[model samples]
Target: MEPGSFWTALIWAIVPMLLLLAAIWWVDRYEKEPLRLLGLALVFGGVLAPAITYALDRAFDIATSLSSQQIVPEPSLGVGTPLVEEVVRGLAILAVFLLVRFEIDDLLDGLVYGGIVGLGFGAAANFVGIWNTPSLGSDTDSSLYTSLISQLNHVFYGAVIGLALAAVRRREFPILLGAIWWVDRYEKEPLRLLGLALLFGGLLAPAIAYALDRAFDIATSLSSQQIVPEPSLGIGTPLVEEVVRGLAILAVFLLVRFEIDDLLDGLVYGGIVGLGFGAAANFVGIWNTPSL
Candidate 1:
């Protein structure tokens, strides 16, 4: 490991990846994750995972040193190296999971965190891969390119694993829906009517809103979220969305007049509709639900 090569590799690797991570964080339109948490995840990926991977790889090499076949044919580093690296990276991704349970603002937020870990992991791996290669000194430019390609591969795999790991937060949709049901207390809306409202509010109405929004967007060149009854307003998506949800409930109320007895009944039914819509919209989920 030449000192010059190591510094060159480290600089090249860290700078580009940090920029990419910043881009990912910036492109997040709806929610901005805390920079503190993002920075923490980057550290976990770049430092912690690489150190652990090195240790594990060394241990494996030592464990297999005395093997009869000289560690060549049966279980070579080819298969084992990637496995070990990914598992270590995965552990780092898991560490990220612990940092942002409550702060995750969107589904994309989870993906951004996963991406941060991956970019960091890839960046750090380049330090090792590029420094060890003798060609890094003689063929600086080409070596840097190859190192970049390798890092991209690492980033790709790590991001994928991170995306998969993001799903493990596990939210139960019915919990809040059930709470809203409990709020009716007296003269509860019929479950049949509630289900109708839930599905219509959660699924059907949103589709209608999307179609209308898209139609306006194409005609007016406004953002999809901005295109609607009020083109000047960018919050049209939510406006239309809430109206559609209310219509679904009103449709149910009209169809089942006996069930909606008073203001309290309407409130309970309306709350359920909103919860269903929220669950589908990614506005609320298992991670953010106030269970109590």
Candidate 2:
């Protein structure tokens, strides 16, 4: 692609992602979180986090006899990658949680923070993906499709992560403590159950995405062979994924009646999960790009 064309396509690809981020921010209208933290999270997601993962992968390669091909082919959307990436991404939220436990106050606050972190992670990852990919000699459609899919997938994944983390924190610690406190004092039987449910759902999201991708691939192959109708996102696959995620959120909400006052906690927790999911996805997306 010409330099001019590449610039145009890049701009187009970015605008919608920004709009989506704005929409998410608008939806979370309670506390307007500082853009500085959000920016930091994005930096962490796009650069520091991916760098750390890359370093770890390299270390694994050096410590063992694993070939690049063997390591590179590790499932991108599976239990293994998500497990590792989620922990790394969660660190961003954990950092904030530690410092601001006094301000968190409610479940929804958790969701908001989680979403912010996830949005930052997703944006950084998407930016990297777009920046690294060649313009494909001016075929903007491919780039646009890639951007759209990347954005939506990251957003969804982040949301789920936010919800899961929120649920867990709600159960584990309902009140803030000073440095000397060794344990949480809240008895949260309900939130504990909700946390378990969130864990189960968060674990399942990637599995479902993988299954749907595979199913779509198979259906497309069959369609090409004239054996079935064309397979697309509209074939009930995306809906199924959404339903599963919704059920997970509902399970947590139903189980935990922590009090309306604690809504911020939920938001913050959900946001953290989203941040982790988005950061993980972003890391993989950048790492797997044609160029490092």
Candidate 3:
């Protein structure tokens, strides 16, 4: 193959693999692993490990070719190259486990990380497979099919490593469960109440701010015209804005007094209200700002 063709085939083969890897990443939606560790795992498993495995596979193939003694039957995939490849991949996973034990939180985390490592391996392997297949007289469709199958195979093998890690963790499951239960029993709050508080606070904050601003302007106008000889406008705007933003929390308190069970709950509700008001004010400011 020409250099351009080789590069194009490699890109085509690797694109789907990357998309699948991204999907695997979303499986651990919350509390993602550190980027550096994940990157390291991909590089080590995908590049370094494959290079080592390739060298070992070549040595095995050379020894088999040179042997004079006749074996009853040639080694099948179940006991031959497939098995060796799995072990080589497993070694990569084992190294990650030993180096970064803290990151392996649960079964799902193991599955995600293991799948990533496998994805790297599959991508490296597919690059070579896609590049070499045309020389072996395989069609483009056949090369694509092989690439897809190889990616799936590697991801599945990587998931097996996750299963093993899960099993290891499960041995102390009872102790872990008991601790979790105790903590949850003490700190549990209804999801519905929290959602309601945040929703009410966010939606009501802007309206409350608007009403207070109108009322303050009217008062200021009245005071300037008749009630006060001098217009005390210096502190009026800041005072009105701060109090108006704060009224959202008061509204929440009136709406769901029972939900605010503790000081921490109050702080959370107040923070949400402030966040909403600030967001609204920011949007208005940006929308009014002149574009360059």
> Which sections of candidate 3 miss by over 4 Å?
1-5, 62-78, 136-139, 169-292
lDDT against the true structure, per candidate, is 0.60, 0.48, 0.59
**What TM-score does prediction 3 earn?**
0.50
Query: Candidate 1 at 60: error in angstroms?
Result: 1.8
Q: How displaced is residue 35 in candidate 3, in Å?
A: 1.0
Expressed as tens digits, the lDDT of each residue in 1-292 for candidate 3 is 3211567457855787779778877877787888887887788668877777667656765211112111223342235656666777888887877676778877666777778788888877766555544343323343344355557768867865754555356542323231222223445546565566566555565565556545655222112212222132334534455555566568777877877676435545665666566666666545645555
Q: Which 10-residue span in candidate 3 carries the lowest summed lDDT?
A: 63-72
- lDDT string, candidate 1, 235-288, tens digits: 343355556766877876786677766545665566666667666655422333
> In model 3, what lDDT does residue 114 have?
78
- Stretches of candidate 2 off by over 4 Å are 1-13, 54-79, 134-138, 141-143, 168-292
lDDT of 3 at 7: 79
Summarize candidate 2's per-residue lDDT along 188-242 as a digit string, tens digits.
3344543554464555543454465456552211122122322342334334444
RMSD of 2: 10.2
> What is the TM-score of each predicted model, taking all chains together?
0.50, 0.49, 0.50
